[model samples]
Target: MQILITGGTGLIGKQLCKALLAEGHELTVFSRNPASVPAKCGAGVHAIGALGEWHPGKTFDAVINLAGEPIVDARWTARRKQVLWDSRVTLTKELVRHIATAGRKPAVLISGSAVGYYGNRGDTAMYEAADAGEDFAAQLCKAWEDAAHAAEQVGVRVCLLRTGLILSNKGGLLGRMLPAFKLGLGARLGNGKQWMSWVHIDDYVAMVLKLLHDSFASGDQASLALASGPYNMTAPQPATNAEFTAALAKALHRPALFAAPAPLLRLAMGERAGLILEGQKVLPGKMTAAGYRFQYPNLDDALGNLFGR
Candidate 1:
């Protein structure tokens, strides 16, 4: 299959591209720094500086949309919020427009979303069918998904990946917390009771590959049935922030003995702090029912795999 991917140099995109490349699938990556794509994503990846490069004559079997600003990297000032919105929603809208005009439309569009779509639901279990939250992050994800859903009208299968916290040896939520955990400065945030839906990077890549290949490539009725719509890209067993902290500390042979108060986090991060202080217990209800198996369902197992313990 020939694939075009946005954010192909990102954490998840890098790994996903490697997997696709290993399977002998041709990949074209859209990047701000087109020259760096071959170095960052891998050799043999054709890089495009703009979506316009994909002329109407150009064709792709599949399109993976993962471009977005790092939501937690900076404070959510008014400007920063707009940047987030434009990067995801605006880009997706443009991608769909291009898809509509394509001489040969892709069979499927695997677009990115986040578990933040559920907002601060506390212990309430969220599934793919759950309603959108009213918070900024949730609204952002809803609009982003809505933009991607436009491809369906053109007869393209659309899959929205409502991803959770991804655990990997490289950068992500785990990368940001590893330094502190390794030094035994690990602490739970806000009382540590907020539920966290997470997935190991390996499982994340595998699930995506399944959707790309099985859902559209193969003519399996079950696969086609599960091909479109939202999927909670999360592990089966959700954990609390406290449980995640303890598991990481245990995997690193360190002690966790402190807490980051919610007030301090709010003062430091402002509205962005809600991302940490509040979370949803999202489950991969659709994925599981679709017959996808999880490689790392437990928090301890996922951390152990990452730490090689």
Candidate 2:
């Protein structure tokens, strides 16, 4: 299969590309830095600096949309919020436009979203059928998903990935926290009761592969029929912030005796602090129901694997 992927230079995109390549699929990455994509994603990946390059003459069997600015990297000032919105919602809208004009529509669009769509729901378990949240992050995800859904009108199957905190040694949430935990300065945030819905990087890639290959044949009783809808790309079991902290500390043979108060986080991060201080207990309801098995279902096992314990 021929696949066109946006944000192919990102952490998840890079890993997904490697998996797709290993499966003998041809990949073309749409990147802002096309030259860097081959080096970052892998060799043999065709890189395009502009979306315009995907004209009507060009065709792709599938399109993967994962382009987005790092949401929690900086304070959510008015300008920063727009940057986030443009990177995700606006960019997706444009991608859909391209798909609409394509001479041959792709079979499916595996677009990126986030569990943040559920807002800061304390302990309420979120599924694909749950109502969307009204916070900034939630609204952002909602709009992003909505944009991708437009592809349905053009007869393209759309899969919305409501991704969680992806744990990998390369670079992600774990990469940022490893230094602190290794020095034995690991700390829980706020009261540490907020849920942390997460998935191992390997499991995430496998899930994507399943979605890409699963039969989408309509009215075929034998097919998995994973045609279209939102998928919570999280592990079956979720852990509280405190549990995750302890697990990380234990994995690194460190002590977690400190707490970053909510007030301090808010002061330092402003609105962006909500991303850290609040969370949803998102379960991979759709993925598991579709018979997808997780490589790292438990927090301890995932951390231990990453830390080589």
Candidate 3:
């Protein structure tokens, strides 16, 4: 399958490209700059100058949309919020418009969404069929998924990935926390009790490929079923913030941290401090029910794989 990925340079995108290449699948990237394609993505992986240039005449088996701004790095000011929103929702709108205009529709459009769609669901389980929450991130994810779904109106099968925190040593939350923990300065955030849904990079890449190959490549009859809706690419087990901290510290052979006062996080991250202090206990209910298997189903196993515990 010739897959065209929008954010072929991001952490998840890079890993996904490599996995596809290893599986002997063709890859074409829709990026602003062809040269920006990572070295691992290689010569066979040709790239287009922009998503706007996509035409149905050049249809591919699948189009994975992972383009978005980094959510946790910056303060959530009004302007920053707009940037975050535009990167996800606005760009998604543009991508859908391009697909609609293209004469040939890609078999499947696997669009990026997030677990934040459930927004701070303290105790309730979140399913892919569930309604989106009512917060900034929630609203942003809702709008983003809506645009992706518009492709359905144009007769395209679309899949929205309400992904969880991707745990990788290369980047994401685990990367940022590893150094601190290794230096023995690791500590819990707030009460360290917020539920965090996570997926190993291996499982994440596999799920995306499976979704692409199953419904899109076979030219199977499309329905309004989940074949075109949303799915959670998360692990079956979700650990609390404290559990993650302890597992990570153990992986690094360091002492686990004591409790971190919740106020400190709010002071450090401002309104966005909740990004760390609060999170959804998203169960991979949909992924498992869909028959996906996880290489690392537990938090301790995932951490051990990363740090050699």
Candidate 4:
């Protein structure tokens, strides 16, 4: 299959591209810098600086939309918020427009979203059927998914990946925490009770491959039902902040003796701190029901794998 991926330079995107290429799929990565794309994405992947760079009549078998600004990088000032919205919502609109005009429409569009679509629901287990919250994250995900869903009208199967915290050794939430925790400065946030829905990078990539495979096999009437709607790309078990901290510290052979108070966090990060202090216990209902097995379903196993413990 020929797959076109936006944001193919990102942490998850790079790994996904390599995996797809290894499986004998042709890859075209849409990148901001075409020159750097080869270095960033490695060989066997074509890179385009702009959508217009593609030939007018060219089309992909599938489109994976993962282009977006890093959500928790900085304070969510008005400008920062706008950047986030434009990167996700605006980029998605453009991708859909490309799909609409393509000579051969892609069979599937796997768009990225977040479990934050459920907002800070505390302990309430989130599922695809649950209503989204009214918060900014929720609103952002809703718009992102809605934009991608537009392709369904073109007879394209659309799947929204409501991703959670992605755990990887190279870079992501866990990477940033390693240096501090190695020095025994590991700490929990806001009493460490908030639920954290996270996934190992391996499982994340596997789920995506599964979805793409389903799309490839779904050309017939019976198989067409295999890929549709939102699929939560998280581990089966959702870990709390405290549990995550404990497991990471154990894996690192470090002491988790510090706690960042909620007040301090809020003062430092402003509204962005809510992401750490408040979280939802999201479940991968759709993925599980569809028979997708997670490579790392628990915090302990995931941390152990990452830390080589």
Query: Highest TM-score: which candidate?
Result: 1
- Residue pairs with backbone atoms closer than 3 Å in model 3 (clashes): 56-104
Q: Rank the candidates by TM-score, best first.
A: 1, 2, 4, 3
Residue-wise C-alpha lDDT for candidate 4, range 1-309, written one tens digit per residue? 888999899999999988988889898999888888878887768988888766649979999999999999989999999999999999899888889888899889999999988888978889889988888888999999999999999888998999999999999898788899999999999889999999999999999998888877834755557678898889989999999998899998999999989999899999888888999999999889889888788788898898888
lDDT of 1 by residue, 166-208 (tens): 9999999989998999999999999999998999999999999
Comparing 3 with 4 on TM-score, the higher-scoring candidate is 4
Estimated TM-score for each candidate: 0.99, 0.98, 0.94, 0.97
Extract clashing residue pairs from model 1. none
lDDT of 2 by residue, 127-227 (tens): 99998999999999999999999999998889999999999999989989989988999999999999999999999999988888873455664444554
TM-score (C-alpha, index-matched) for candidate 3:
0.94
lDDT for model 1, please.
0.94
lDDT of each: 0.94, 0.92, 0.82, 0.89
Q: Each candidate's root-mean-square deviation in Å?
A: 0.9, 1.2, 1.9, 1.1
lDDT of 4 at 104: 90
RMSD of 3: 1.9
Task: Judge candidate 2 against the unseen true structure and give its global Cα lDDT, from 0 to 1.
Answer: 0.92
lDDT winner among the candidates? 1
In angstroms, how far off is 36's CA in candidate 3? 1.9
